[model samples]
Target chain A: MADFNASDLTCLRGERLVFGGLSFAAKSGDAIMLRGRNGAGKSSLLRVMAGLLAPRSGALCWNGENIADDRAAHQSRLQYLGHQDAIKPVLSVRDNLRLWGQLRGVSQLDAVIDAALHALDIHHLARITGRYLSSGQKRRTALARILIGQSDLWLLDEPTVGLDRESCAELSQLIADFRATGGIVIYSTHIDLDVKNPNILDLDDFAIPMVEWLTEHADLNDDTNDSANMQHSVSPQEAVQ
Target chain B: MSGFMAVLQRDLRLALRQGADSVMVVAFFIVTTTLFPFGVGPEANILARIASGVIWVSALLAAMLSLERIFQADFEDGTLELLALSPVSMEMLVLGKVLAHWLTTGLPLIIAAPLMAVMLNMDQSGFVTLMIAMLLGTPALSLIGAIGAALILGARRGGVLVSLLVLPLYIPILIFGAGAVEAAQLGMSATEHLQIMGAILLLTLAATPFATAHAVRLAIE
Candidate 1:
């Protein structure tokens, strides 16, 4: 069983501190529901987990090995679904799915792709180009990608934004199946998800306070924004335990 | 290797399906090159003298026209983030993209340059040198331009921004490429100029993928 952990994660975006003092851990078959309002750093935390964004101060590890040390291995083991639906306008749905499978070095894609397409209920739209797909269809296509390749972890950012009710139900079913197969899913969504016994991570609890953000920005002008000073600025009492 | 090929093949297929993007780039090269004679007058001696510079400059601009789309389309639609997350190193995926760009934009420019050379009253002796020079030079344009393309991934008016960012860097290729034909026309060996262009191509080939990949990573962040 794989173990994923994040400790003392602090994220800075531009001149603003998005989040500070965040930590979480997951094991095989674990489902994590990241809860936060818009702009509460849900997406940033997800990106950090996917290794797409480096935290200002934190370490992400899988099975006790630092993910940063072996990025390719980390990347190979996870699938990330960002806010944008990555479908190419000119390519048909099947070709798009096949293209990603090929990218993952999945040589025998015919059966896997067909199964993924079926899982998302997009088998009928396989021949249609992405330009003609509705937002719901496009979201389904993007979600279907998570199943095309073998991955132990999934980092989905606002995955259900454009999905319809039926498609959302299909996604929940897919997530349940994925967890049953020893996969760990960490997803952020506003809608209720049906996954069992999910570890709920409330990002609001980790959000860097506005007053602290202002002080940090104020430090930028003083040229004293070094990590030493920044750490001191966060009162020991407020830091996450 | 399969990851690289996957990106390359997918990009090539997209280029083929769109079909017009490549055609428009070639057409822009042709149309832009054809205007030189009308602007400078059809004097054979002058046209012949200016053909190398004119063709190279037009090719540079034509190549620039297509640069923004190299990474911008993927960046916008979010394919770049996924590509970055894939097991393949960003450098390899970037190289695949640069090759696809060269095949679609640079290759067509090379093929169409000879026709423009003939129309500009270029010396017959310089024709082969011009084709050879472009063959050695255009890939470098795509390579260097990929850096600019990747840089301008989220910028406003990125097409214009790419030209401004990439044109200065393209000057070396422009000089050597045009100079090769000029040297050949003067009955001198164009090998030295060709070699310099080849070196520049190899340098960009080795370096730009990494640079572009880094820029792509920053844009994704």
Candidate 2:
């Protein structure tokens, strides 16, 4: 089964502390939602988890193996869909999806792309140039790429951003089905997602104090003193609450 | 390799769909070359003497005109990020783009330079040498321009910045390309200059991809 564990993950953007000393794990068949306000580093945390962004300090492992040590192997099983759609405006929807599937070494990409477009209700638009597609259609096209791939982990950043109400409902159901198939999904958004038994990580409550402390002592050396500072800053009540 | 072919195929498909883009690049080359004669007057000796330099400069500008789109469109639309995240190394990705650029712009210029040479009343030997030099040199132009293209991604006024960053690096190509034709005009074998251009092409084909890949990553970051 696929599982990801991030231990003591601390991320800093210049002097601003995004997240610090955070930990989380998601096993196969699990869906986790990352909730926070706009500048709360939810996207940053997702990037760090995907191994696309490096953390200031800590480790990220996939299936008990360090992602840093085996990046290619880890990346093979992971698919990250960021805020941008990543489609080539000059190419047709069919070409874009086929190219992505081919690059990822997936066989029968045509059938897979067809299925994905059908699922997204965009099969008729396959021959159209991506530049001509509506914003929501383009978003659905991008999402189709993720759906067609056989990745174990899906790191979706606002997967439902431009979807219509029916499309949004369809995607929510797709996420549920993916989890039911024993795939792991970790997504970040400002909107509340309707998922079954989601392990919600509310960045607002758990993140502010940690980020504030990290911002203050960002220059502290990686020694016992830093740990002492962390302990002194967070009392027992603050730790749990 | 399949990865290389995949990238090449994708780029070609995009270029074909945007037919006017490639056509405009070739038209720019011809128009720019035509402007020199009008500016310098219809003096055969002067035009013939400066023909090699004018043709080479026009070719360089044409190549530069197309370089920004080598990765900018892809990068802006997030396709570059997907390429970077793919199993294929960025170096290979750069190589694929360089080859595609050469096929689209550089090869056409080489084929069309002779027509421009005839129009300028260039000597037969000089025309042959000019075509050979362009064939050897334009690939190097495309390869080196990839690094510039990758670096200028997301920069303010990126089109102007791309030329500013790339023009200086193109000096060597211009020198060798023009030198070969001049050598031929002087009745000397242009083989040595052609060899030098080929050497630069080889070195760039080996190294520019890695540098371009790093620059692209920095741009994304």
Put down candidate 2 lDDT per residue, A116-225, tens digits, no spaces: 99988899999998889999999999888887778888889888788788888778888898998998989986566677888988776546465457436646534467
Please state the i-RMS of candidate 1: 0.7
DockQ of candidates 1 onward, in order? 0.91, 0.54
The best candidate in terms of lDDT: 1
DockQ, cand. 1 = 0.91
**Model 1 error, position A74 (Å):** 0.5
Best by TM-score: 1
Give me the chain B TM-score of candidate 1.
0.98
Question: Model 2: which residue pairs collide?
Answer: none
What ranges in model 2 sit over 4 Å off?
A: A206-241
Residue by residue across A105-156, what tens digits does model 1's lDDT show?
8868988989999999889998999999999899999999989888999998
Worst 10 residues of 1 chain A by lDDT: A218-227
**TM-scores for every predicted model:** 0.94, 0.91
